[model samples]
Target: MSDFVARRPIWSLVILVAVALLLWLVFSVWTPGMEAAFGRKRVFLSALFNGITLGALYFLVASGFTLIFGLMRNVNLAHGSLYLFGGYLGYSIGELTGSWLVALLVAFVVVGLVGVLMQVFLFRWMEGQDLRQTLVTIGLSIIFADLLLWSYGGDTFQVTTPDWLSGPVTLPLAVALRSNGEAVLMTYPLVRIAILVGAIVLGVLMWLALNRTRVGMLVRAGVDDRDMLSATGVRVQLVFVMVFAFGAGLAGLAGVVGGTFQSLQPGEDTRILLSSLVVVIVGGMGSIPGAAVGALIVGLAEQFGSVYMPTYAVMLTFVIMVVVLAIRPQGLAARR
Candidate 1:
């Protein structure tokens, strides 16, 4: 399979081009139907913006998941729990202190501490035991969920954003109205744009860390061959523990960002976790760039699907996963 991919790399390029053309055709033919369904041509711009914002959030969450899995091969099912917990904690702190920035900082630190504790108390003992790791993390997730439900109740909550980020920003670009009226300028929540910018910055930083730093070299080496890394006298366990904590911190930060824009509820943990799983599977298990691409695809599919095929929107992600897997089981950027 690797040889085939290497020899005929253009095949992947061809597939991508075909997919783009198909999407263009579908959207072109269906634009009128969409405007009719939504009663506005602005829905196109709205959906596109929403998709990009949502994809940014997904990338933040999935990047952490991929990092942990790529380095330690640990399926941290409790990751979503950490996300919800972080949001709830942030909410509590923000309400108490009346400071969103404080809440965000505290949430990241607290969740990172929890991650470190979980690694020390639970995962460290079960090294190389995939089944045990999975079961334990699942159990922990259930426990965290129940605890959160009991304490926070099932009601949805949204974190308060800073004053500077509360309003919408109008874009310089505008779209023509379906009624042949004057073009309307699009506006989006400033917070959403912040999230997108944050994701991009985080992606670049992560890329640099992985490619330009010694720690990143160790991480990549560990992902490729843990036994060899350990044999080289690197403190593999310590490195993994730090990686897990960092990943968990990222998840916690994403939770707070997401909760600020969307509502946080009882099932968000599972939903985000599932979304992360889909992203990593489609993007390539450990590839940062792959995660970003997968997140964008999933985000766009979700937004467009909800508008055009509301009845089947939920199934769209699964369909994408299936299609991607059929074409490239190892994912879009799996290591060769």
Candidate 2:
């Protein structure tokens, strides 16, 4: 942190100011004049929390993408299809069993198994062949999308938010001051907050698994020099398969998360795939911290842009991408 401040004091100062401003905006009670100028605090706070939780959702999907496409450097274009498939399957399972947790577990296992199959049959021999992997996955994505459309149709579906997490909870932050000198606290969907907490915990666990464990060491070593690691008698193929399964499982888990809060539809796969791609590219491929930062930025940009500049909201993401590419193409948290 000190190194960063020393190297780029101006940027550090700018960031500090921005954070301070955001904190003030979040905590301060808005007067009529302030509300008239910048809109209501409730709307702003809602957008802020929405952005945060949405970012958490994006991180879940992109973390898996980071593992496969980012860390392993295998382009799995069918990833989004995996997500949509998981959601549909989870929803079906939830309907049949009336157990959301069971549906989540089943989705993870089933989708992880699918990933293992893809690894064994499709990707095993094509290790260094990016073009082949890309083409095959693209074809697979199309096939998966068609299959899902046939099975589920184009109707929108949302997983039943479990009874435990169904309602809105009031936050401590004041949205406005009542005439009685009381603060009006903001109320948000409890499920979103729960998901955000889950995402954070999951992210920390994943980071620890990848960075602090022996298996993680092997995974990293294999990525850096597969031949050398294989020469070390590390059962590289098995590790690869396990990695694929885990990555795909994470995508499946994220599907359940999305289905809980957001509706699932036909073109949802494409949108999610694009979002994951943007997050990965923006955060720097293969870095978990990068994924988090990238997800947060993209989420906030989308939410705040829609709130403040609806007409250009879609363009804002691409613009951020362009600016990042021009300034720091490696991404904010990616290693130099």
Candidate 3:
């Protein structure tokens, strides 16, 4: 029991459960009259679901950011650019093919390839040169942002949820809740559920891939000591390139997934990137669980802030970030 308590993995699980419980308690108290006003319990439930969905999307982007930053020590100012470009590509592809799934896949692969090429052509050369790489990537971000603005004309574009997911799902608990002083509310958008499911699935897959797979082992080893791995005859450069590519691919996938729910414009990239950076910083660099925790907190804060305090919603994330950092500069789950 003591060994288990001391283990990071076990503590991580405990933290997750604690956070979930806290969220449940907070929402239940804050909206005690929700059922009376809305005539349904699903409204409050959906808000929690919505928070998870948003967190899932943030996890996708922030996971990538964490990985890249952890291994390469690159701040990756261009990450947001990749995200924007992915949305544009996915939108364009969907417009042509009229299939959202195909567009998502195409966007992931294309953006991933771009990441690999970027590493190969630019980052690889600047390895060990942190300042130069940061400046160069910042320049690249500006260039990409300007090009996207010029091409897309700053217009907001929407990605339609598939027909199958267009309607609501009457959750299993809808009818059961009526007996517990809760009102019946059955209809909930299926798309939102899908997003939540997808994000959870992705998070699990990422964890397994990182913990149980050979590639993941290489990644962990690389993060710990790239020089040692290279000295051991591992193709460290190739691994770095692949890691960067995978990270970028995850970001692109997020863009495509999130774009379905919210319209994308040229400016959204910056908005999301800033949020993602906050998530990364608050969560702790290179920690997947940290990213999830940070993202959920940020997401819920955004949701609640928007509903109850619209003006503070914008500043809410930064405020939390500052508090967290002040208390723990290494982040809430900082390993170092």
**Candidates' TM-scores?**
0.89, 0.97, 0.88
Clashing residue pairs found in predicted model 1? none
Please report how far candidate 1 places residue 156 from its true position, in Å.
1.1
Worst 10 residues of 1 by lDDT: 22-31
- Ten residues in sequence with the least summed lDDT for candidate 3: 171-180
Please provide, for model 2 over 77-196, each residue's C-alpha lDDT reduced to its tens digit, 9 standing for 90 to 100.
999999998999899999999988998999999999999999999899888788889999999999999999999998999998889889999989998777899888899999999999
Question: Please, what are the lDDT tens digits per residue for candidate 1 over residues 1-336?
Answer: 578668789996797798897556434433557557755645766787899899999998999899988887888999999999989999999899999888888888899889899989988898999889989999999999999999999999999998988899987655444456555666788999998998999999999999999999999999999999999999998998889888998888888998999989999999999999999999999888989999998998899899878999979999999998999999987865
For model 2, the superposed segments whose C-alpha errors exceed 4 Å read: none
Model 3, span 169-285: residue lDDT tens:
876444224446774545667887788788888889988998999989988888888899899988999889988999899888888887888778887888888989999989998
Pairing residues by index, what is the TM-score of model 3? Answer: 0.88
Candidate 3 collision pairs: none
Query: Which residue ranges in model 1 land beyond 4 Å of their true spot?
Result: 1-39, 177-182
Clash count (model 3, backbone only) = 0
Global lDDT of each candidate: 0.88, 0.90, 0.83
lDDT score for candidate 1 against the true structure: 0.88
Cα lDDT, model 1, residue 305:
92
Candidate structures ordered by lDDT, highest first: 2, 1, 3
